[model samples]
Target: MTDENGWDMSASAWVIAQGENGDFTRQFVLDPVIDAWLAGRSFASALDVGCGEGRFCRRLKARHGIVAVTGIDPTEPLLATARAKDPAGDYRLASAENLPFEDHRFDLTVSYLTLIDIPDIERAIAEMARVTAPGGTLLIANLNPFITASGGTAWVKDDSGAKRFVKVDRYLQEHSDWQAWRGIRILNHHRPLSRYMTLLLAAGLRLTRFDEPPAIGGPTEARAAYNRVPYAHVMEWTKA
Candidate 1:
C-alpha cells in the first residue's frame, strides 16, 4: 500500500465520492477556514502539494484570482482527473517530498489533508519550504492531531445505542491508520500536535495562524456534536 498503485485503483471511486468540492467534513468545516485564509491574499503563483483532483487549485484561480496555480501529486490517476477537470491548468505527477520546481518558485503553497497520507512528512515539509519564496505563505489543513491520534473517528454507544461521547486515545505515540469508504482505501499516519509544529519550525517556517473551526452549514445535530471538539486543524506558516 506504500506504492501509488492503490490510489490508481481507487481513482474513479475517489472522484465519485468527493464530488465537485470534497467530502462532508471538508465542505462543511475545513473549506471555510482555508477560504478565509486565502481571502484578500491573492498570489502570483500557487502550488498545491498532493492535490487530489485539483479542486482547490481551480478555486485559487476562480476565487482568489491567482494567475497561476499548479497542482502536484504522486498519484497519476488523481492527476489525470485533475487535468480532465481543468484542461487549461497545470497538473503534474510528482511527490511532495521531491517537488519538481526551483527554489522560491511559488508565492503560496498548500497541503490540504495531504500531510497525514505522506510517510516522510519531514522531507515533504522541507521541500515545501524550499519551493516557497522567502516571506511566502504555506497553509496546511489537516485532521486534528487529537482526532488522528485517537486512531479513527469513533463514538461511545450507550444503553440506547446512541453516540454518547467521542473516543480519543493514543495522543502520545506516532502511528498509522487505515480508512475505507466507497471503494476508496488509503493509509494515514498520525503524530502529536507538538510534532507537527516542531517540524514546521525546524523547516524554517514561522507559524502565523492556527485554528479549529466548527462545522458550518451542515446538519444541526452533527454540527452540535462537532462543536464540542473539532476534527480538523488548519495552520498557516511563512517562510522566513
Candidate 2:
C-alpha cells in the first residue's frame, strides 16, 4: 500500500524479497554491471538517493571502499529497517527532489532504480547533480523507458501459455502507472529516453558511460527473451 506521501509502504516485503543483493533483476544484472563499472572509479564519500533499505549504502562502505556513505529515502518504514540493520549507518528520511546538503557535497551520488518512483524527476536529477562534486560521478540505474512503456511488467502470452513478447503502448507519452507485486503497491512514472538525457544535459552533467544490462540467470525462456529487450539503463555522469 501507499503512504500519505504516495510512497510504497512495503519496506518489509521489499527487504524480504530482495534480501541483501536485491531482486532478480538487480542481483543478476544491475549489481554486476554497477560493481564492475564502479571498480575503475574512486570515491571517498557517497550518497545513495532513494535508498530503500540502505543496502547499497552499506555495500559502498564494505565493497567499494567508500569510508563515508549516506542513504536517504522518503519512506519511514524503509528508513527504520535500514537503521535497524546498521545502527551506525547514516540513513535519513528525505526526498530526492530536495537533498539536505550543500553544493557539491558528495564525491559520488547515486540513484538506484528509484527515478521511476519519483514524480519530479527533473528536480531529483538536478538535486543529484547538485550534490555531486565537480569531476565526481552521478551514477543512475533506472527502469528502461521501453520496458516501462508496457505500463507494467505484464507480458502477453500465447495459446500454450507461453510468453509472446512485451507489449509497449503510448511510449512517447509521459504518465504514471500502478504496480503491485507480492504485498507491494507502488506508482511508477514513464518518460522517453530523450527526456531523461535532455534533463541531465541541461543540468550540466556529461554522460560518460551508459549500458542496458539484460537479465542474466532467471527463468530460461524469460531470460532469453529479456536479453533481446533492454530492461534497465545504467549511466555514469560527471558534473561539469
Top lDDT hit: 1
RMSD of each: 1.8, 1.8
Question: What TM-scores do the predictions have?
Answer: 0.94, 0.94
Model 1 Cα displacement at 118 (Å)? Answer: 0.4
The true-versus-predicted C-alpha distance at residue 60 of model 2, in Å, is 1.0
Worst 10 residues of 1 by lDDT: 1-10
Residue pairs with colliding backbones in model 1 are: none
Query: Candidate 1, residues 8-96: lDDT per residue as tens digits?
Result: 77888988988897877888898888888888876999999999988888888888999799999888888888999999999998888
lDDT of each: 0.87, 0.87
